[model samples]
Target: MLKGSAILEKATGKDGTQSNHSAGKLLMIIECLADKSEPVRLMDISKELKMNSSTVLRFLTALVDNGYAKQEPETARYSLTYKICTLGSKVSSHIGIKDVARPYMTELSMLFGEVVCLAVEQDREVIYIDIVQSSTKMLRSMQRIGHIAPLHCTAIGKLLLLNYTDEQLDHVIADKGLTKFTESTITTKEQLVEELQSIRWNGYAYDDEKCEIGARCIAFPLYDVEGKVIAGVSVTGPTARMSIKQIQLKLQPALQIIGRLRKELGYTG
Candidate 1:
């Protein structure tokens, strides 16, 4: 037991008691699906969460009943339903961060001649919320809106890390140790801290051939109304065409545009 955890247990006065929140249970079931390593089985949920099989079935039945999920009759396996996407779309529309970032991301790709991506912190990683392609004719990937990436290798990843304190950054490092992809990838904890510190001061990041060999990326912190850095936007391109300095000099103006869009959305900063 850590010092603060023992203090918290004494204060809360019921350390052994577990929370019985239904919403928490539902989310735990969803997370259990992710751990199955294959299409989910009810047994996986029960075993992983240590909940009763009957209880897991009942919860899953309720989700299936509501169209939030579905079970395969042939296999007795369950998966998220199409309705989840509809519900997700409805939720994303009102998330405020995604709504505020769309136009700036669009304009950045148009101005930079590269692919622009907007991502938000999900757990200790980044989930792509929006992507704007530079041109249809250029070598471009169809951006999947919900794809996730490591928060230590990509430009947007490091940009988000800029907001963390020394201790929170330590937690991130412990949760997801730095993984290397290319020769330039920062694989150590201290190096990431130094990089984030510079990003905090310079207000932008340059990922030089880190995630992919030929790819170079640059990103900046996106502030909400109160100047809180909640998310980030990045522009990616081939390293052959976009040099390190060019990423900073040519596309650095995207920061100003993103700042204006945030302001329009009532972001005071």
Candidate 2:
């Protein structure tokens, strides 16, 4: 077997030690499949992953057999399968950081009668990792774990953005370019920078009709071992039930849970 250290030097890392332990090549293939606006062929996957066609074929065969990929027989194109989605949902539900939050999330939604969600900052946007829907007849988009959202609009997005260092934030802003979704969404880079600072000091962030009209949300960060923000937990709902005072009053419980879950996440800080 190849020594781990030898491979570590070749893998890329953001912190300088090229120590990415993930299945980088396979992940690259997955990325290509996701990046395409539509399903891709084996040749496209092979080219994107920069691997030999035969090697790519073997990988796809295994992935398809394992239910990670689905292939159209006539077209020979591959796409993500529902099984992969099921596995993703299962993993998100059982992740260490989210495990303790599940019970709390359930209670929080019930308490506020709103939608509770956990979001993580991935790449340049926010990815909904977990969500607890309160009312059965709620009027909002059904957010799945893999669904992506704008980083400058949602309450959780602001809270998660507050966790990043100034330099990191700059990089993200440069990449994502402060694209505005709704009219109320933060459009200026300067204003967003200011909001991030406020979020850090307040220990919470607010989204008043930014993500979706008539939806108001409040969010706070979930920290990790070093007091580093790993993800954000938030509650959102219709403006009628999500009034400012109600959101403020409900903030403490979420903040309290945030405190407990932070410790549970091994945050010594």
Candidate 3:
């Protein structure tokens, strides 16, 4: 059986120099496979990639051995396995999200004169990945990138819970224990469920001094290419400036920007 190590060894040149030719070819083959919906014949792959039949077979054999691809039993055509999607998901979870949202976060922070944050859920907790500080010198919420906040008491956190089932919500509450940060924090499972329903209807979430006294936030969901909520973007500030009245006033423009962002992310719904 062909091995990845052997492929790498073969990629070395006679002058004892390593080249990325084989790796590039492998990527081309993978892209070719991904472009097609059905399993592809070996000759088709070789023709499309302009590679030798034997060379393509070697790479395909290596890919099959490594579980990245599989061959159909009857037709002997090749197709990618779910392992490729798993790897892509892992990469997608970490990269591009921050880069894509940073400009929008900056725009919101500048417009609202408050902190704008981009966060995603990890292990049932909200993790702030990027934060754009307020443009103004006024007092704002002290939210830092990489800060972990409870899902039950944060705008972005609660917005991220839109897809959770009742059982999943119960599991989260049981494990995370809905620790009350303020009197406004939802401590009971029933209250949290009701709050989620309201968020679903409202199409956004509010943090009315729930996580910290005198702090307020409004959050909207950020979708992925497939229209799935991958993360959330929120604007947070002191209650004096981010009061309910002010939030209601700024909601339309904020949502407009968020809608543009969603479209940029390929979310149609």
C-alpha TM-score for every candidate: 0.63, 0.64, 0.68
Order the numbered candidates by lDDT, best leading: 3, 2, 1
**How far off is residue 168 in model 2, in Å?**
2.7
Better of 1 and 2 by TM-score: 2
Which candidate's TM-score is highest? Answer: 3
Clashes of each: 2, 0, 0
**Tens digits of per-residue lDDT for model 1, 1-269:** 22323322332333443323554666788667645555688887788899888878866776666666788889989887666676575366437777777778888887778888888777788888877777742544423579888889888888877778889988988888888888889999878878878887887888887777887788877775566667788888887767876766865476678778767767774
What are the C-alpha RMSDs, in order, of all predicted structures? 13.6, 13.8, 7.4
- Superposed by TM-score, candidate 1 places the C-alpha of residue 222 at a distance from the truth, in angstroms, of 0.9
Candidate 1: pairs in clash: 225-267, 225-268
Superposed Cα deviation of residue 139, candidate 3 (Å): 4.1
Q: Where does candidate 2 stray beyond 4 Å? A: 1-94, 135-137
Candidate 2 lDDT, 203-240, residue by residue in tens: 78888887787888888788765666778888888888
Task: Evaluate residue 174 in candidate 2 and report its C-alpha lDDT on the 0 to 100 scale.
Answer: 79
